[model samples]
Target: MTADCKGTVRNLDRNEAAGASLQASGQRDQVISFRIEHTDEHGDVTGYSQVELRGEVIYGGLTDGDRVEISGRKGGDGILRPSRAKNLSTDSEIWVSNRPGVKILQGIITVIMLLAFLTAAFFMITGISGGRFP
Candidate 1:
C-alpha cells in the first residue's frame, strides 16, 4: 500500500551526504529528504515532519522552497519510499526507482538458504533410516 503527502523541500543535505559517501565507497546511490507539513481541515498547517527517500532523483531538480506532492509506500524498515514526486513550484515531476540488484540478491540468498536446510534435513532422515539414529 502507498500514501500521499504534500510539503516543502526542507533540505537536500541527505543527497549531499550520500553523494560524499558514495564517492568514498565507489557506490552509486542518493537519498531524498522532505519536510512534510500537515494541514488541518481548514487548510491550516497543523504539524511538520521529515521523510527520506532511497533512490535517484530523475528530474525536476528538487530544491529548497519547492512545494511538492509525493506519493509513496512505507517500507518494512518504517522508511517512506517515494514512488513519484511533483514539484508544484517548477510544475515538473520526478520518478523514483529503487535499485533492483539488491532485491534480486536477497531473493537469491533466501533460496540458497532454503535449499541448504532441505539438504540437511534429507541427510538426517536418511541417516535415521540407516539405523544411525537415536
Candidate 2:
C-alpha cells in the first residue's frame, strides 16, 4: 500500500538541485530529500522518514530545502517510488495520472442508452403506423 508523507526537502541531486533536466522520457525526474515524519498504522510516530526520494514533477520547480508532500509505495529496494507529489510551499498538484480515463467508460454507457432509446422508438413508430386509428 502507498503512504502519504509530508516533509521538507533535506538533500537534492546536484543536477536537479540547480535546474530541471529533460530526460529521455521527456518527463523531468528529480530526486529530493524529504524529511517526512513516519508513522505506524496506529498513528504513532516512528521517528523515521525517507531521507531521499525521486517523486516531484518538474512543473512545481522543486529544489533543495523545499517543502513537499508525496505518496508512494515502499519498494523492496528500500526506496519510495512516489506516484504523486505536491509542493507545500506553492500548493501545486504535480502528478496525478494514476486515476483518469473515466470519460471512455461514460461514453460506452451513453452509447448503450442511446441504442436502447432508438430500439424503443423504432417499435413505437412501427406499432403506431400498423394499428388502426381510434
Candidate 3:
C-alpha cells in the first residue's frame, strides 16, 4: 500500500540490539495498541474497546504506543503488504552489547601483568647468580 498507514507504536516481543537485523526475507507483523470506538448515526459513541494492530509492522522505534507508518509489499501472508517501515519518532533508545570489549581489555591487562612478573623474576635470578646481593 502506498498510502501512509497510521498506527500506534508498541514494543516488540524480542529484545533487539542497536543496528541489528530487523528485516528479513519473510512476513513480519507487529502488535500495536489503540482505542476503538463505534459511533451511532447521531455521532454518539455507542461502544469502545482497546484494539491491537497486528500486521506487517516494520521496526519503527523503541517505545510502546508510538505512531508509525508501514510501507512495502505484503508477502503471501494475509497481513498488510509492508515493504518497508519507519518509526515516526527520531528519539529512540538503541541498545548495544559491549561485553566483548570489556573482556578483551581484561585479558590484555592480565597478560601484561604476567609478563612483568616473569621479567622481574628473571632479573632477580641473574642478580643472585652474579653475586650482586648484599
Candidate 4:
C-alpha cells in the first residue's frame, strides 16, 4: 500500500564521521534517517514519525525545519519507503526508491539464475539417459 506523510524535519542525521569511516571501510550500506515531528492546529506537538532512506538517496538534501511530504509504498514490515519526497521549504524534490536501474539489475540476476538452473537440469537429464552417470 501507499501513503503520504507530511511533517517537519526535526533532525537530520548525516551520520557525520561515523558514516565516513564506514564508507572508507566498504560497509556504508547503512540507512540514513531523519526524525519528523507532527503538530496539531494549536501548534502543540502531537506525534512523531521517521523517514528512513537508503544510503544511495542523494537528490534531495533534508535539513532541520524543512517541511516535507513523502509519498511511497509501505513494505511488509510496515515501513513507509519514500519513492519521492518533496521539501516544501526548499521546493526541492528527490527520489528515494523504485529506481528503474535497480529493477533492471534485479531482473537480470533472476534471468541468469534461471538460465543456470535450466542448463544444469538439461545436462543432468542427458547424462542420466546416456548411462554417463554410473
How do all models score by TM-score? 0.54, 0.43, 0.31, 0.57
Whole-model lDDT, candidate 1?
Answer: 0.69
Can you give the lDDT of residue 114 in candidate 4?
100
lDDT of 3: 0.46
Q: Give candidate 4 misplaced runs (Cα > 4 Å).
A: 15-27, 75-78, 97-134
Root-mean-square deviation of each candidate, in angstroms?
9.6, 11.1, 12.4, 7.8
Q: Between prediction 1 and prediction 3, which has the larger lDDT?
A: 1
Predicted candidate 4 versus true structure: per-residue lDDT over 1-134, tens digit per residue: 88788889876776433544343224444355776778898988898776777644356677889998887777776666675789899999866543558657878999999999998899886776554556
Prediction 4 TM-score vs. true: 0.57
Ranking by lDDT: 4, 1, 2, 3
Q: Write the per-residue lDDT of candidate 1 for residues 94-127, one digit (tens) a residue.
A: 7766557766787899999999999889987677
Shift of residue 2 alpha carbon in model 3, Å: 23
- Give one clash count per candidate, in the order shown: 0, 0, 6, 0
TM-score of 3: 0.31
For each candidate in the order shown, give its overall lDDT on alpha carbons.
0.69, 0.60, 0.46, 0.71
Worst 10 residues of 3 by lDDT: 16-25
How does candidate 4 score on lDDT? 0.71
Residue pairs in clash, model 3: 9-65, 9-66, 72-82, 72-83, 73-83, 74-81
* lDDT by residue (tens digit), candidate 3, 80-112: 433344555654432222244655787899999
